[model samples]
Target: MNALGLVVEYNPFHNGHFYHLAESKKETNADVVIAVMSGNFLQRGEPALISKWERTKMALHCGIDLVIELPYAFATQKANTFANGAVSILEALKCQSLCFGSELGEISSFLGANEFLHKSKQQYDELIKKQIKTGVSYPTALTNAFQELTNGKEILDLSLPNNILGFHYVKSIREQQAQMKPFTIQRTSAGYHEQNFVSPTIASATSIRKSIFSNEGDITNYVPSVTFQILNEYKMEKGLLHNWEQYFHLLKYSIMTMTEEDLLTIYEVEEGLENRIKKNILHAQSFQDFMERIKTKRYTWTRLQRLCTHILTKTTKQQMSFINDSQTAPYIRLLGMSSKGQEYLRSIKKQIELPIISKLATFRHPLLELDIKATNTYNMIFEEPLRSKLLKAEYATPPIRL
Candidate 1:
């Protein structure tokens, strides 16, 4: 009755993901798999290619025993917060271990890197700040600084998808002092960013999404048969987030009307990025364009998008500080679970420290309430048909018939 944990977005599950799940089961001999996944929006600050339910179905179809929603506050945030939220859920699930895909897939290398970063003192912090002052991007500066100590081998850069996320997971585990063990499965076939899908059962989600969007060919070759079957039940178009354009006026107005203090209240604002953001708000045409105009060496694209999402969600600096100072998340929201998962919940229900939320109607905490409001606003950005459908989206779909 061992249980393993996974933290994922599955934005759309593909072969590489399927491989990781199978490997996790084999390596751990676990009877149940629990995942804390992103909801409508992803960490990159972009909309998920599909709805969260679709992604959950995909995971359940591929052997996951339970799927929980990672709140938007963490999902559309930077690596640290995103990891903080996801890892918190996994720890609360009482998993014995966590398994994720990694490019190097060498656990020791990541551990060594994580340790070095942890031991960094004033000297290391100053070096990174100094490098960043020289106009190198934050990622580049951090990499260069770590290279000084490890001869370029100890630092994991976030610009690359998997490695960046892997480091965050490691860091979060250390921060929490959680008991779950960590493991990695080397990624194969298409790389995280690779656009082509040539592998028999290990294509990147990027390639699968491209194929699904273009209607060029059947994607069954890259995803599980169950995934293709569920996807076939509907016609999904690219940028299920197309209605995002409707927010243009709202964004423009909010930026223009907000005071300098208001801009500073947004999370991720630092060292006067607020002024630049405000300046670009009036001149830039679209969200992407505004982001480009304000982009700077100190701020990464994902960081900037997080700032935008923070502003869009009206998250203030005060709130960010509050959440950070708070050591634990308020609740773990359940997305879907199998009968075995239900049994696990019963086993851990009292032992688990955090509250588990399955419905939104009676949720009263301000932070939890904020998550609900954010999801409602997120639903408004979906196409007309999906708008209500997403709000009414139910959990506990019949267990994935694998």
Candidate 2:
């Protein structure tokens, strides 16, 4: 069976995701659609609005054939690292093509951008470093470097969020020499980070999440029936949607109690950031306030959030350092699967490069350790029996079979 792969964070499996899933399969002409989805936390360094299993059920109900958890080590990293890990998992699954939604919407543009960067890698690196030295954010430096290199030529725009991730996906595929062909579809209606509704039916996940959090507008039209139902069910059962603000006190406590020396050991804590964090922790009122207190031109809010996530989870530099040294994921963690997905897995199981892990107890790895820890930390936001129940579910729940 031919499988098409997607790198996703469903968050709540909104309509935009539904469109992407359908388009990906149609574009690739594949028999099954497989997704490498983030677990508990996201690339932007925020806790998922719901649990990974909840999101997995959302995916399965939305017609996704398979869902594989993108381990904590990669799920919360920068775009390139996130793409690398997701792409590697897809490649390991023997996918025929990997499709992503992007502003550019054209695969050629991503391919060209990757080729250009590969050819001018040293120059681009120097330009990025030069821009960074001037106190600009890393993303700004990247945009400036890309502009300088392209010099008005129509290459992929690195400034757009989806395009940036798309470029990285293409780059990773090339770097790994994977067989999967890369494909892109134009994102419809809403931008990746747009927090306002742009269409009646096709709103960004950001907008969907904001509306859900604020309890303002009805999001029924913005997501599929399954998504709406699952989201409501999750909220009813879990009591609240997960968010940074919900975890702020614990994060504050973590920062307040840890010594500066100890905070420095957390991944991404560098150049006396620990000092800045210590100085700001006492005065901040909320996660937003704390982020504003520490926000600087050099460190993007997203970057800082990832740093905070690391701190909250107590993920040490030593642990992440080991992960960065590896080229590919150590295992493929199956989160959920439809019957078709199971058939595809059975077909590829013998030749797949990584171990296919369905049960947590059956598989062990240094990376899996971080995933478990992240789940534990994520569950901390819940009260009493719910917290213990969620934590127990992590080990006891089997992969969802649709």
Judging by TM-score against the true structure, name the best candidate: 2
Candidate 2 clashes: the total is 0
- How well does candidate 1 match the true structure, expressed as C-alpha RMSD? 3.4
lDDT of model 2 at position 225: 92
Collision pairs in model 2 = none
Q: Write the per-residue lDDT of candidate 1 for residues 1-402, one digit (tens) a residue.
A: 688999898867877788899998898889899999987667877656656777788888678888888877678776667888888888888888888788887677677778877887566788889888898877777667777756655355444668777887888888899888888888888898777777776778777777766668677778778777666653444234222445666667777889878888777777587788777888888776887898876677877776776777777776666467764567887777777788888888988888777766545566665566566656665567856766665322333333
Q: Which ten residues in a row have the lowest lDDT in candidate 1?
A: 393-402
Task: Evaluate model 2: give its TM-score.
Answer: 0.99
Off by over 4 Å in 1: 153-159, 198-201, 211-218, 232-250, 256-260, 281-286, 382-402
User: How well is each residue in 1-402 modelled by candidate 2, as lDDT tens digits?
Assistant: 888999999987888898898888889998999999999999999999989999999999899899999989999998888988999999999998999999988898888888889999999999999999999998999999899988968787888999999999999999999999999999999999999987989999898899988888989999989888888898888788889999999999999999999998999999779999999999999999999999998999999999999999999999988667985788999999999999888888889879888888898898999999999999998889878988998999999999
lDDT of each: 0.74, 0.92
TM per candidate comes to 0.86, 0.99
Tell me the TM-score of model 1: 0.86
